[model samples]
Target: MFDESVSKKIHVPLVLSMFIGLLTILINFFYSVEDIRSEVYSSQSKELRAAYVNGLREKKVIALTNVINLSSNYSIIESLKSQDRNVAIAGLQTLSRKFKEQTIYKNIKVHLHDANLRSFLRTWDVEKYGEELAGFRKTLRDVKKNKKAIATIELGRAGLLVRGIAPIENDGVYLGSVEFMQGFNSIVKNLRKNREYETAFLMKEDYLSVATALSSSPKIKEFVLAVKEKNVDKDFLNSLKGVEIEDTKNFQISDEYFLVSEPIKDFSNVIVGYALIGEKTSMVETVIAKAKSSLLKQVYIIFFIDIIILIYLIIIVRKKIIRPIVDMEKMAQELSL
Candidate 1:
């Protein structure tokens, strides 16, 4: 009976203690993994944003330089200020033909506006975009009002565009502004081909304005294709809504992905859209598995040592304390008899 009681007491407490210790270790290990994952994601996000912004800035600078060079010419300025549509049209055509071979003017769309914000000419084949005033209006206003150059990444009718505007001035007289825009497909193309990562330009409502992924993986290709306007999953949209500039978070579509979103701002500093750069979870999953395995290994070692200690205590107590008391009781009973 004494032995039975000793077994019940020691075994129950030993099992409970082991369970508690294992639970604690598991909790701690998971917390550590989360912290490490967040740190890794954040560090990588900053690097990606910096690279993307640098590329974008370079493109904007090129466009601004071209606009400045073309618009600053005395001939272009005189044509713009002539107040005659025919002269403006003829001069613009001559300038276009003259510089058609220049690499800087290639693939660029130009718009010239007068001082009252009236349209003078556009390189497009249309007769007019109407006097309604289109394109990056704020940038036009800044260039016209301040008589200086301005540039920004803005959402346009066709797609996301990098725009540059500079005042058409001759001898400190501001005739109007010359605005130039180039589609950002080249930027996205460079990112997809040069950097082996997926890139997306998402407007409001999870609309994928443009998306591309590295061709190295067929899975990534499929993933990017499915990430169109209508195919965005609800969970992913909800998760994406909360992402801010330079903030990194985990999201899921076909599978888990870590995404860092940077806001695409206009000249007025408004968040017109977002640029999402992401990597598949498979890469980080491998890291997390290794970390957890290492943590569990430590837990196993500690648990083994604890079990040995518990067993040793049980044996010591039964022999030095419980067994001795029972033996003394028997001796006393025999002497009394």
Candidate 2:
């Protein structure tokens, strides 16, 4: 009788072990599915961010080219090449006014150069915004040297400016430069208003912050300073001299971030600036939270169903297999007694 009771207890555990094995298999399967889903989500998010950055860069380049072509019209150049500074200024003023009224740009300045490429006639609204002629002159030199369109994000005595430099030639002679300014805040604000992402415009090797959508962060300020210092690092800039666009990289400013950087190309295809797009770690955290919530709900539902099936299987096994063995052991024990 004692042996029969021991056998019945052992058989009960055997039946429970089979159910436990099934539960283990189910857990592993769920884990694998979740892992694969996470990988897919990560890959898709990166691709979408990269496409967005590239599209924005292309749009900026197109707008710049159109501005250059508009400024390089024959009549505009001829007016600048004229002897009278007043006439050139008046003509440019009228054009600037018209552009401001029609387009998104707020201000346009005309710089006229002599045959020797020296600044002679320059017209700008120096009252509202201070004179940036010195910097404009440097930009002219860059255009002449590169023989191509030049774009820069500059912080001048005037708050902030995105300047585009295009050469103007009249009758095969390089006359001067046409400097166009679009307010930096306006550009960045408009971008933020349109999208739900963070964006920044970086000038070539200038570590000063040109424009950003971030409200205010001390860390961001430090990053700007570091980048500016890095720009003056001869070795670092030299390494990026001939490179056009940097690959998508994971960058950690204060925390981990998904970063994509693209070169801003001019009409002539020279890399004059860079565009950086960053998705914050907080954004990823939000995504992870949502994923966890969704997965937990799914896992709970599956677990509930598993519990129901396991209970039913246990009852069936106990009655059909375990009970029969118990009855047989009792009969054998009675005969031995």
Candidate 3:
């Protein structure tokens, strides 16, 4: 009876200990995986935001510097002072052509406004746009009053426009301002060339709309526009209130995306729009999957080693303890016989 009781106690405790050890290992492994995933998501989000900020800073520099230089151009000032409209038109055309000669400024639009904030010359169509700068009255007034350069992202009559305005002066007298507009389309085109990532510009009004986007294929722009018109992702609309930089978890559009959003601010540091960048999730998933696989293999190896150790311990107990007790009992019975 004692031997039987000993056997039961040893087997029960040994089996239970093995099971408990396995459970503990499994729990630890799961926690490790979660930690790794969180770290990866955070790292990727920071990388995307940093890239977007650097790109935006470069473009701001280009636009502001370009406007400042054009505002000081002798031709632009001379045309503003000229009494004859024809002379002004000719000088403006010559200045436009001069800018077109440079590769970077070839596709940019230039507009010359008078002292009263009236558009007098434009590279697109001087005749059609030769009216008051209607929608841009606030920015025009600010530039004229401050006598400083200002840049902003705004929804114009044509579409979304990033415009930079600088005061034009010949002899301490504010003649007018030189307005340089870099359209959304042009901006996206340039962005794609520099970074081969999916990009979108979102502007908020009654609802958030995709001002412009470019995906893997050229047709993706149309799809993005439709998504905006339909107000597809309400989550994105809510997230646009603040400057959020993070990876999307199972995006509504698709599961294969990591989204990064940065706020677009005006001269007064007010949020006007958002620059959304989406990258493929495959890169991150593949890394995580590999790590999980490696961890699983290590767990399996540990389990195998544990099983061998358990078996060796059982053999030692039988040889040194259980067998000796059995032999002594047998010898005592034989002596009595």
The best candidate in terms of TM-score: 3
Can you list the residue pairs that collide in candidate 1? none
Q: Tens-digit lDDT track for model 2 on 214-306?
A: 223112212321122322323322223222334434332223444455555444355545555445546656766666667667667877776
Q: For model 3, name the residue pairs that clash.
A: none
What order do candidates take by TM-score, descending?
3, 1, 2
TM-score of 1: 0.57
**What does the lDDT read for residue 154 in candidate 1?**
58
How many Å off is the CA of 91 in candidate 2?
3.3
- State TM-scores per candidate: 0.57, 0.57, 0.64
Candidate 2 residue pairs in clash (backbone atoms < 3 Å): 207-228
User: Which ten residues in a row are the worst by lDDT in model 3?
Assistant: 217-226
lDDT (10s digit) by residue, model 3, range 5-113: 7767877798789989988998999998998787777776777677766666666677788899888777788878773345556766776677779555665678888
Candidate 2 TM-score, true structure as reference: 0.57
- Of 1 and 3, the candidate ahead on lDDT is 3
**C-alpha local distance difference test of each model:** 0.64, 0.53, 0.66
